[model samples]
Target: MLTLAAGASAPSVATQLVGSGLIGLREGLETGIVVMILVAFLVKSDRRDALKWVWLGVAAAVAMVAIIFVAIHFGTSTVTGLAAELISGLASLVAVVIVTAMILWMRKAAASISGHLRAGLSKALAVGPFAVASMAFFAVGREGVETALLLVGYAENTAGSIWPLVGLLLGIAVAAALTVALYFGAVRINFAAFFRYTGVFLVVVAAGILAYGVRALQIAGWLPGGSNLAFDVSAHFDTSTWYGTVLQGIFNFRPDPTVLQVVAWAVYLVVVLTLFLRPLPAKPGPERAPLPEPSNIPAS
Candidate 1:
């Protein structure tokens, strides 16, 4: 949607499906893993009753996100021009910040996250099902909200909401099916590889969004020097041309980019990618030697 909104052509259904499928696959796998971990923990502790709480939390989170989406949608309808631009720009910036934080958190604490979750769940279960549900709600809610915000931005920009939304729904449905399969040990995929690649893709996508947001601000006349055309490729390739349209849809590519937009895009890609690809810090060595039983927590 971000791509389309930035003057890119509308994508075919196949392309939307593919893109949404990838997103769904990644997100679904993460959620699946979390649920699996909870189930496993419950089984180990003989606390099957707590599973209900997890479901409650998931439902609550979904509802909360839905409410937010509706509010933003209706609110945007009443606002025009600069107000709409500011809203979208601010939302994009918030998404960028949240995504950045999430990436950093994953990098710094991936190894210990499972352990922390297990500890929290153990405590929550003792407090009853409500506590369990709250934990689950928050666990899933964070991912859900982020996905919703990003999708909304995409929808607004591309004017291709119907297809993308359909694609997103389909992707999620497939993911849910796969989750069930995973529970039965009927499917397996290297999650580490999946996250690594998707993380890189998301970084690029987010950078494009950041650039798009800046352009929006420029359009609203909030940002300076937007009137000056940095360069023009309209002579060689019109925006309506097949190649131009495709480039626009895929990467939010503009033949004529402003100085600020170009600089923002370049700097974002270089800085974010460099930081994202850097080697993570090593975990500290254990103080004690071997234990009688092995730990369930996996090493990063």
Candidate 2:
């Protein structure tokens, strides 16, 4: 049983795969849809010549993400003791922030995403091939970086387990297939609902990461009251078992969390999730013109 402290139970391997898979699916789908929209726009516009440039930008983004992932993986491997703990701890916190922002941004911006891409494509086509490639690079690169950051964050806790990596790769593969179908008009998706539900999932996951960050800080001696037990249910939900690991990876469930950690998790979920799920205010309808006043002395 892995432990942060003397008796803390680490998440089981199964939990790692499931959590990473979800992240991969969600992030991959978001990025895929963006590419799908852009490609479709190009095809419909009969600008097939520029397709190579688009791919060029995508290739660049993918290369950059891969490089960063390897760098972090190798870079952290050499660090030992408190230094490792502090860096990983800081990474988890940053992941929480990035995931939260991406969720909220997707929620609000999804509606106009297609339109925005179409506009961007039109602008880029006029500017020349380099601009088209640059746009693709920036758009795809943003999502790629976000995905990589979150993965690095999760990678820290699992320690040498590759299931998370496998799960994510599978998700991206599936996403690519779906994007192709979407672009070819082979499928139709209710994107609004899709994002809304996935946004909810991400929010919950980010909450777990948030709590993980808190615990990591405590472990690194960055937070106070490490020994204070908010509650302990190790006997009830032992992490060595599959069920316990499920809770561990999915919720960052701590049997003996400090009071501050508990409070932070609760507040984040309540406030962030509440705001996220809240129905957007309806757009006011156009006002109808008032009827013209009847003429007093009129047409004979």
Each candidate's clash count? 2, 0
RMSD of each: 4.7, 9.6
Q: Encode model 1's per-residue lDDT on 59-86: one tens digit a residue.
A: 8987997787667666655678788887
lDDT of 2 by residue, 95-142 (tens): 788778877776666655666777888899999999999999989988
**True-vs-predicted CA distance for residue 251, candidate 2, Å:** 2.7
Q: What lDDT score belongs to each candidate, Candidate 1 first?
A: 0.66, 0.74
Score every model by TM-score: 0.84, 0.87
**What TM-score does model 1 achieve against the real structure?**
0.84
| Cα-based lDDT at residue 2, candidate 1 | 21
Candidate 1, residue 135: Cα displacement in angstroms equals 0.7
Clashing pairs in 2: none
